[model samples]
Target: MATDIPSPDARPARSGRRSGDSTTRTDILVAARTLFGENGFTKTSMRAIAAEAGVDVALVSYHFGNKRGLFSAVMEIPGDPVLRVTTAAAGPREDLGRRLITTFITLWENDDTGVALRAMLRSAVNDEGAATAFGDFASGAMMPAIATTTGLSTETVRAIGSCIFGLAVMRYLIRAEAFTALTTDDVIEQFGPRLQAIVDADT
Candidate 1:
């Protein structure tokens, strides 16, 4: 009879590989985000992301199709707040502020949203196209609805938009310790009325 035994390192190596595939995908995204933030979308390439991630170029395409798709995935956040707010606002003008703030806060509390938000802030700082896209999404979709509900002029609506976006920046992007550390209820308490004030302001 003959007995064979695997090396001590073999089991650990195999165990590491059990999650290697998924970890590779995550690595690609992280590398992509860093590259995109540093170089902007136009200059950052699939090849570069793969190189940074230490993965094959084919893996990038296989997972995300192209740069745009990969960027979209990297930018995806939890809760479709844009859609939800638009849908909810379609029915009536009243209750818009509360609903919008509630939805926005709920979404921001999630990990996915935090990841997307960090990417968005970095991209906006580095990429002109990303800044334009973010601005358009805010003014076209969110601001107009809030303006309609509150009967504010476009300029006032935009001012309110700035305030809301500023809060996100201060809290998340800048990681203003005070703002970031605030509990959900504390955030609502501090900003809820102010947000309502913006919506209800006469301009």
Candidate 2:
């Protein structure tokens, strides 16, 4: 009789999963992305996202590990954005705008995460909730880092962020004739100094 036992510890965890987990995970991602876009990661709560997704906070934690992890999962960011900005911030202060804008645009244009972001932005235009979310992340999360990196004040950052947002909406989202007529390089040349001025003002 001593030869017949397998411990619970020895069992595979995956064997215990319900078929509904896939749907739950997707639900969590959708809800988290919306909340994060609207309120930013620092302000959105796991409980709030879970409640929006019709799940428990425990399930959200189990799926994404933590708030930071949830944000990364929602955005499909390759690395922590703070670190990404810090690394990109390293070099001449003069080149900061070009570097930052180029990097930011590249991420939004990439095939993998960019595709998801594009779809989300399209949805955002027609939906108030989506627009709130997009606005929150862009102004709250994205601008702060650029402000820090450029030694600019928060107010200046907001000004710079507005310019970038307009560029994004015109070029990528709305496909406005004015922005679309200019090449990426042309935009960078024309607008990069406007961004650089915020940093220059600080110095």
Candidate 3:
């Protein structure tokens, strides 16, 4: 007679609360929030969070996928920023700047993504750790990807990122009437070509 096999869910439950438990997840989040605020995103290591939570480092990955994922959780960011920006960069070289400007403007206007983005920007402006994390994400990952796609130097791409960053700060953070009063298309029409100029600097 063939023996009956146990289904995956029917298997014996683990004895402890450490195995994918809600309490464990809460511990990690609490630890991550404290560290991320105190040390900033770039400076706070996953290992430190794991240690602080009294859990294995792998649990951090299991719970959040990676450092950025963990940061997104701690910061309540809705999605992967690198993926979003790089995806926007994908297209013909001529419109790279336009696409980027459009992307940032769209992100700013959206309710779900915009609030988290503005919060992060506010934190970055005031906190050194948050600033470094933003710089690294832009200069290290996002800028390099845009540079490769557009044949522009990372410095040039970074300049464009800075311009958009300033736009965000002015429009949202400072609530400057000049920037806030303009329609999305107005902002894009004015700034797009200026960003494109940096892209075309070498040409």
Candidate 4:
């Protein structure tokens, strides 16, 4: 069954300035991130963000032009994942796994990236459009490139992608004790080789 997708304009209450002023813009982004992370993108609204940031609704339009733009800003992710993956995947196939894992971890460890990811995940759960956005990013950016570089099948590549998503969910969102507390090095040491195996699998 098709679900009702929440518009960005339908969000809950927020705590700050209105949207257009420099301070308000910054405030809106910050509030939007928190709400988006907590409630999923579909459920978050420009009105709520404006309220949270103490700004007017029109200012949101003036500053971001729309909810998607606000989402992009909150995510803080660079160009589309496809471009990012293509650029990052430009080395020897054998080194692709390690490089990918390393780069991904580094990006996630950053506070901004972590918050962005949280928002993305939340959005994915509530909105098909958001899920499509994420899928395009994963497929166009990461999976195909990994498959091409490492000669893995599409399914295998997707499995590796699943692993990455699972890891993030367990470690960050769920805060699984061991996964959460592990030092970055500990995680890489344990999961890196497994990810490589998936990428280089015989299937």
Instruction: Highest TM-score: give the candidate number.
Output: 3
Candidate lDDT (C-alpha), each: 0.63, 0.67, 0.74, 0.67
**Model 4 Cα lDDT, one tens digit per residue, 40-106:** 6545667777766776777777877676567666655543444455566677766666776776677
Off by over 4 Å in 3: 1-17, 34-45, 127-129
Candidates 1 and 4, the one with greater lDDT: 4
CA deviation > 4 Å runs, candidate 2: 1-20, 30-42, 50-59, 72-83
* Model 2 per-residue lDDT at 24: 87
Give TM per candidate.
0.55, 0.69, 0.78, 0.57
lDDT of 4: 0.67
Compose the digit string of candidate 1's lDDT tens values, residues 1-203: 01012222211211122223868889878876666555555456677677667776678878876665676666564344355556644544445556556666766776767677667777776776566545554555557766565566888667656766787888877889988898887777777677666666654
Error of 4 at 199 (Å): 2.8
How many steric clashes does model 2 contain? 2
Cα deviation of 199, candidate 2, in Å: 1.8
lDDT of 3 by residue, 1-203 (tens): 01122222222323342646668888888877766656555456677777667776678889888877777776666777767777887788788778999998998899888888889888878977567656655655567767776677767876887898889989999999999999999998999899888878855
- On the 0 to 100 scale, the lDDT of residue 131 in model 3 is 71
1-203: candidate 2 lDDT, tens digit per residue? 21122222221222233334669899879877766666655567776676667765678778777766677666555556666765766679887777767766766667875676566657668877656755666666667776677677788777766776678788889889998898767877878787777667764
Cα deviation of 108, candidate 1, in Å: 1.1
